[model samples]
Target: MKKDVILELAQRLRQAGISGEVVDPEAADGLSDLDEAYAVEGATRSLALGAGERLIGYKIGLTSQPARDAFDAKEPAVGHLLAGRQLEEGRPVPVAGLFQPKVEVEIAFILGEALPGPHVTAEDVRRATVAIAPAFEIVGSRWRGGARSLPMLVADNTNAAWISVGARTEALPRDMGSTAATLSVGERTIAGSGTAVMGDPAEAVAWLAGHLLRSGSRLEAGDVVMSGTLCPPTDIKAGDHLVAEVGGLGRIVLDVV
Candidate 1:
């Protein structure tokens, strides 16, 4: 994909995001491959960073088999995470600022050391992780409904909107795969385990690091990576108070208002 084409698609995405108007990604050319989609994402990141948003970390999408099947793909996707959208524990997740809002449970890893990909393993992620916390990744798409593919999702930054992180724990469990997560919205609750995310949350981080390294990037210190979701995402609306609990970790509350 040409640089100009990438920039053009990114600008369209930015406008669609701000105006809450979903656009079709197929309308853009050269988005057929993952690399091209990533290029578009890089261009979008550049636009966001140029507009004063700081890159805090990255988001890994579709690490679980179910998630991948839903997207009609076998591999995972990655997205950039900006600083201002990082909400603290117990903070209100303002719905007024989002486009088609949804939420999912994830374990966020804050890195203490740089981990470059390709050779990065799950143990490497665990060793480099300085803190682990329960998180809610608020997802929103800038694209309208249609035959959306992984590339389209990738180009849209893996539908990243906001990240709500709870209190961080310095010690990670010996078996992160066994950690259970429950997401409650009012009376309905959805449950899953860390194993849903590639058998372990750390494994997802390792996958993202390796993917980034293959693309010539690395996960740096101070970067917070939102490992893949534990369960399917729940659609959200205004006046919805949501809580996510992770066993052995802690809980994070998000009020959609």
Candidate 2:
């Protein structure tokens, strides 16, 4: 995609405070024709328009191998973080504004300082992390019934809608990947995964930093990063019990409605 079109779309969407039915494929020769950077920039613009703020951090979606195979993606896709969409632990995720929502378990990170991208390491992620927190993410696909194209979902903040940040755990392990944990929604076990997230949740965070740096973006201090889904995402419904607990990390709960 043309650099000008990227900024233009962002500018237009920000000014309008409304999302187009889908980016005019012709406008940028079809987003599928463009690269990932263009998609990320367009999404950044849309969010900036609709009361979106600076990207605190990013997320690496589809971390599990099974999920990776299902999506036919060799690597993880990224998404921006918005403060307005963040939710506290043990809170209900508002069903409004979400169409065909799904939920995933993840470990979130709190950065301590600015960490520019394009050349970051899992250790960099480790140094930047102040703590690990249990999290449940509400993913709303731009497509119906969870059918989302890679470019489409990437452009729509990785289908990221709302996030439930659970309690911050004790000091993080040197290698968070090996950590084992269970997830439950009000006494009922949902599913579980740990180091399964890209071999290390920090690695996923590192990938985001590098991806953004190459796109002229950077991770800032005090930013919250969604490492990625530890387990496969599950369909969600109202009145469901939603609780998540990482091995070393504690637990968090939210209501479907």
Candidate 3:
């Protein structure tokens, strides 16, 4: 894609984010490939950073096979997480500023050491981790009616919106793949295991590390990497109270207002 086209697409997406409006997915048609899509994402990241938003870490999306299939993605997608978008546990999330918001239960990995990679492994991810926490990833798409193509989705920053994290634990779980997660909204509840996220949450992080390295970046120490969701995302609305529990990690509470 041409540089000007990439910038224009980035600006369109950023404006959509600012106005809480949805842009036409066709705006991303100029992207020639996933690489170009990520270039647009990079441009949007630059725009946010230039606007004084701090980059906290990154989030991995479509780590589950079903999620990948839904978006026609061959692999997971990555997005930058901004500090300003992080919500403290117990704080109410205002739905008025979001577009098509949904929630996912995830395990957050707070890296203790940098994982600069081409050779990063799940074990390496484990070794680098200092703490893990139960988290709620509140995702929203800026593309009208949601993203229609992988390139459009990636260019929209994988629909990242906000994240509410709970307490962190330095003690590693016995077997992350076996770790269980349960999310409840009002009277309904959904559950899944860490295996849902690319067989193991750590493996998802490992995959993210390699993906980042390929794109000239790496997971740095203190970065909060959201491995992926444990189950399918659920729609959220105003006055909704959500609770997510990750066995051995603890729980996080989110109240939508």
Highest TM-score against the true fold, candidate: 3
Model 1 over residues 49-163: C-alpha lDDT tens digits?
Answer: 8999899999998888988899888788899999877886667887654556889999999999999757899899999999999999999888776327788888888898889
Q: For residue 256, what is the lDDT in candidate 2?
A: 84
Error of 2 at 236 (Å): 1.1
Once superposed on the true structure, which residue ranges of model 1 sit more than 4 Å away at CA?
96-100
For candidate 3, the TM-score is 0.97
Clashing pairs in 2: 14-49, 25-30, 118-210, 177-195
RMSD of 1: 1.7
- Give Cα-based local distance difference scores for all models: 0.86, 0.70, 0.90
Better of 1 and 2 by lDDT: 1
Off by over 4 Å in 2: 1-29, 34-37, 40-54, 145-147, 186-188
The alpha-carbon deviation from the true structure for residue 207 of candidate 3, after best TM-score superposition, in angstroms, is 0.7
- Candidate with more favorable, higher lDDT: 2 or 3: 3
What is the clash count of model 2? 4
The candidate scoring highest on lDDT is: 3
Query: Could you estimate the TM-score for every candidate?
Result: 0.94, 0.82, 0.97
Error of 1 at 75 (Å): 1.1
Q: Write the per-residue lDDT of candidate 3 for residues 1-257, one digit (tens) a residue.
A: 88999999999998888888778767766776898989999999999999999999999999899999998789999999999889975688876656678999999999999999699999999999999998999998898888888888899899998898899999988579999888999998998899999999999999999999888899999999998999689989998999888899888898998
Which 10 consecutive residues of model 3 have the lowest summed lDDT? Answer: 89-98
